[model samples]
Target: MDVTQSTAGDVIEVRPMTIHIGAELFGVDLAGSLTDEQVAAIRRALLRWKVVFFRDQALDHEAHVRLARHFGAPTPAHIVFGTNESHPEVYSIAKHRTAQNGRTSATRCWSGWHTDITAAINPPWASILRGVTVPPYGGDTQWTNLALAFARLSTPMQRFVEGLRAVHRFDAPAGDGDYARRVGARDLAAEHPLVTMHPETGEKVLYVSPGFVKEIVGLEPSESRALLENLWEHAVSTEFTVRFRWAPGSVAFWDNRATAHLAPVDIFATDFERQFYRVTLNGEVPVGVDGRPSTLLSGEPIEAQPA
Candidate 1:
C-alpha cells in the first residue's frame, strides 16, 4: 500500500522498509525546524508504519530533544537509568557505562525481544532513539507490529487472549540467572490485558513479551508457562517484523503502544562502541478491547515529570 503523504507543499516521501513494520522517511531533516503540517504528516506516517527511520542528519542532544517535542511531550530520563547531565530528558544507552566493576551488567546486551518499560502502570507512548556512536557492523535493531501479530491469530485464540491479563514485573523469572537479577531486581510490576487497544488508533495489540511478562494471571503454573511461550513465539514471527541497521546520525522513532523491539548484542562482541540517546513520550494507562483498564499490582502510576 502507498503510505506517503505531503504537507505544506513540502512533499514527505515515506518509503516502506518492510511489509508490516517500518518506513524510512525522506525529504525532512530532523535537525531543522518542522512545519505544523510536516509534523502532522509524520504522525500519520507513524500510525501507518509503527516505526519510522531517518538517515544521515546528524543531531546533537538539543536537536534530539527538539525533534521529540515536535511530536509529543518528552518524559524525564528513564526511571532506572541515568540521563544526560545537560539534557535530562535523554537516556544514554551506552554499552561501556552500563557495565559495573568491569563486568557487563545483565542489562548490557539487552538482546531479548521486548517492549519498553511495560512493568510501569503506564508505559511510554513512544520512544525516539538517535544513534550517537554506531558500530561498523552487527548492531541492528528489530521491531514487530503488535497489531499485526494479534490479527494473525486464529479467531478462538484471539478471543481467548482478549479476556486474559498478564503480570509484567522487573524481576526475572526462574532460570534467567544474572539477566533476571539485573532486570527483575527493580521494584516494578503491573498487570495488563493480553490484548490492549491502542488509545489513539483503537487497534488491538498483542501486549505480552517474554522480557517483562512473567505469567498469565489466574492460570496454573504449567499452563501459564506453555501458553506464554506460545504467544511470545507467535508475536515475534518474522513475518510481522522489520529490522533496521544503525549508523551515526540515524534515528528511529516508534510507537511503544503498538510495537515491541529487540536490542542487538552483537555489537558487544567487538571493540566498537554502540551508544544512543533515547527520549520517551509519557503514555496513558492501557485499556483492553474488553473495556477493562490495566491494574497496578505493585508500583505507583507513571507520572509525567517535566523534562
Candidate 2:
C-alpha cells in the first residue's frame, strides 16, 4: 500500500504494513521534509499505526526541534535538571545527557511498563524519538496501544475502572525502599482520572504512568493496590504491543495520549554513550468519554497553555 506524497517533488513509497503497522514511508526527505498535506497524511497514518518508524532519515538538533514543532506545541524538557538546558523543549533521558552529572539525581530503573508523563495533569500529546546510538542487535523500544487496550478490555474490567482515578506523583521519594534509585525524590505528586478521551482526537485512552501511579481513586488501600497491580498487568500484555528495532538516523513517533512505551536497556555497556534529546508536545486538558473535564494530575503541573 503506497501512500502518495503531497507534492510532485518526490513520490514517497509508503509500504503499508505488509509486515506490521500502518505504513513505513519511503522517499520522504527529513531535512526539509514533506509539504503540509504530506505531513498531515503522515500524521493520520501515525494515529492509525499507534507508532510510525522512519528508517535512515538523518536529522540534526535544529531539524529535530523543527520536526517536533510540526506536530503542535513544544513540550518542556523532561525534568532532568542538569542535562536539558540548551533547548527549552528537548530533554535528556539518560545519566550523561545533562551538562552536569556530578550530582545526578536518582531516576527509577524503568524496566517495567509505562507511559512517559502520566503524572502530569495533561501528559504529552505525542512523542518523536530518534535513536542516536543503538546496540548491535537489541535495545529496541516497544509501544503498546492503550486506546486499543481500553477498547478491548473485558466489559467487567472496563466498568470496574471506568470512573476510578489514580494518584500520580513524580516526587515519590527515590531511595532504597523505592522501585529504583536512579530517579530522585519527587517533590510533587497529584491525582488524575483513570480513563480519558484525547482532547484532539476524542478517542478513549488508558491514562496511567507505571512509575508515577501511586494509588487508585476512591478505593481502600488494599483494593487500590490490587486494582493497580491488575491494571498494570493488563496494560503490559504482549498482544497489544510492538517493538521497533532502531537504526542510525531512524526515528519513531507516536501519540503518547493513546500509547505506552518501554525502551530496551541493551545499549548500556561500560563505554557506550547513549544520549537522545526529548521534547514533549504540550497537551490539552483531557476529557472523558462523557465529555466532562478530567482531573488535573502531577505534582509539577505545567501551565495548560505554553509558557
Candidate 3:
C-alpha cells in the first residue's frame, strides 16, 4: 500500500511496513525544516498508517523537536522522568547500566505494551522517537493498530465495550520488577472509554492496555480482570502489528491515540548501549462512541506548546 500524492502536491513515497499498522516514508529530509506541504502529507500518512518510519535522517535533539512541531505542539519531557539538560521537550531514554552488580541488566523497565501517557486526562496525540545509540542486533519496537484491533472484534464484543470505561493508573503492579521501582509514587490516574473515537479520522480504537488500565469502571473486580485480560490478548494479536528494527539515525513517529507500542527486553541483555530521545505531542480528551469524554481522576492537564 502506498500514498503517492497529497492535496499540497508534494509527492511522498509511503511504503507499507505491514498490512495493518506501519509505513515507511521516503523523499523527505527531517533534519532540515519541512515545508507546509510536506508536513501535511506526513500527517495524512500517519492517520492512514498509524505509525511511520524514516531511516538515516540523523536528527539531533534540536532537529527532532522542530520536526515534531510540524505536526502539533510538543509537551514537556514528562512530569516524572524530567527532560534533557539542553532541550526541555526532549525525554532521554538512555539506560547504559544497572545499579545491581554493575552489569548490564537482563530486563528493561519499559518492555510492556502501552500508549504514551495514558494516565493523563488527555494523553499525547503522537510520539516521535529518534534512535541515537541503538544496538546492532536487538531492541526492535512493535506497534499494533488499535483501530484495526477494534475492527476485528466480534460485533457483540464491540457493542458491549463501546459504552464502557476503564481506569488507567501509573503505578505498576507488584512483581512487575524494574518497572515498578522506576515508576515510584507518581500517583497519576484517569478514566477513559473502552472504545475511543479518533478525534481526526473518526475511527473507533481499542483503548485498553496491560501496562496502565487497572479496571473496568462498572464491572465487579473478578469480572473486570477477566474481561480486561481477554481484551488485552485480542488487542496485541500479531495479525494487527508491525515490528520495526532500529538503527542509528532511524526515527519512528506514531499516533499514540491509534496504537500501542512495545519496547523489547532483549536489548538490555546485550552489551550494546541503547538510547533514544522522545517528544510527545499534545492530545485532546478522548471521547466514546456515545459522546462522553474521558475524565481525570488525578493529575493536571497537558499544556500544549511549540518547542
Candidate 4:
C-alpha cells in the first residue's frame, strides 16, 4: 500500500517488498526524516513484515545513529567484542588492514545466519544496519523467519523442542584451537529455553544458532548436539530464507528474536569491505513458547510461567 498524499516538492515513494518480509521506502529524503506519524507507520509496517528496506536513502553517521534512537535506546558496544573504535554505536566490520592482534578477519566472518547475542544475559531486541559497501557480485545477506521456523515445525517436533532447553555459551566451537582462540571476549555462556517467544509479538521463534550456542539441557551432549543440529538445519531450510543484495545507502532492520541472518562474505581477500553502522535495541531475558519458566542452572534469572 503506497501512501500517495504528499506536497509537490515532498513527494516520495514507498516500495514494499513482494514477499511478506521486506519493504523499500524510497524517494523520501530521510533528511527531513519520517514524521512522528510516519515513523509510527513505519514501525507498524516493520512489525507486520519482520524487516524493512530503504534504498538510495542517505544519512550521515550522526544522523544514522540518531535515526535508530527513534526505535529505542542505543547500546554502545563493548570494545573488545565491538567492531568500531571511533563510534561506540557504530562498528567497523571490515577485515583488511587490521593489526594481527585485532583478529579483524576472524570477527568479520560472523556473517553467518544468526540473531545478535541470544547468549547475552539480556540479548538485543532488534538491530538496524546501513549498507555502506556493496559487493560487485556475490556478497548478500539472507534472513530466515525463526518465528515461522517454530510455527512450521511438525507438532511433535514443536512439542519435543518445547520441552528441551539450550545453553548458549560465549563458547566458540573453534575445533582444535586453544580456549582463548575459541572465544576472545569475556566468556558469556548461559542456558536459555529452546523455543523462545517474542516479548512484543507474543509469538514463538526458534532461538538456536551456530555462533554461541553451547549445549542443550536435559539431554546428554551427544543427543543435545544431534537434536540442535537437526533443528538448526530446519531453521535454515530454503522455504524460510530471504536474500538481499546491498546497494550503497540501502538499509535493513529486523527483529532479532524472530530471524536468523547470514551475510556471505562472498568476496575473497578482495578489497571490498562491507562497512555499515549498526545500532542495537536493548532487550530483556527470554522465555520459551510452552509457558514453562526459564531458569538458570547458576544465578541468572529465567522466566516463570504466569498464574
Question: Which candidate achieves the best TM-score against the true structure?
Answer: 3
The runs of at least 3 residues in candidate 4 whose Cα sits more than 4 Å from the true structure, single-residue gaps closed, are 1-20, 78-80, 96-111, 172-182, 290-307
lDDT against the true structure, each candidate = 0.82, 0.65, 0.83, 0.65
Tens-place lDDT per residue, model 4, 1-307, is: 5454232343334555545466666555554566776676566656656777777867776776677777776666432254445556765545332211222222233326567766665667777887777766666778877888888899988888877788765544344344345354445656778888788788887887556566788788788767767788888887777777888888888878778787565565576666666667766778876666455443232221111
lDDT for predicted candidate 1 compared with the true structure: 0.82
Q: How many clashes in each candidate?
A: 2, 11, 0, 3
- For 1-307, candidate 1 gives per-residue lDDT tens digits of 2433554454578889888889988888899999987788788889989999999987888898899989878777876544556888888888765421122233222327778889888998999999988898888999999999999999999999999999987764445555445544557889999999998888999998557787889999899978877888898899999999998889999999999998877777789888888889888899998899999988676666575
Pairs that clash in candidate 1: 170-184, 171-184
- Model 1's TM-score against the true structure: 0.90
Q: Write the per-residue lDDT of candidate 2 for residues 187-281, one digit (tens) a residue.
A: 44556668877765666777766766777878898998777776766776777778777777887877887878876655654455555556677
Using Cα atoms with residue i matched to residue i, what is each candidate's TM-score against the true structure? 0.90, 0.82, 0.90, 0.81
Better model by TM-score, 2 or 4? Answer: 2
Model number with the top lDDT: 3
Question: What lDDT score goes with residue 264 in model 4?
Answer: 62
Runs with alpha carbons beyond 4 Å of true place in candidate 1:
1-10, 97-111, 172-186
Candidates by TM-score, descending order: 3, 1, 2, 4
Q: How many residue-pair clashes does candidate 2 contain?
A: 11
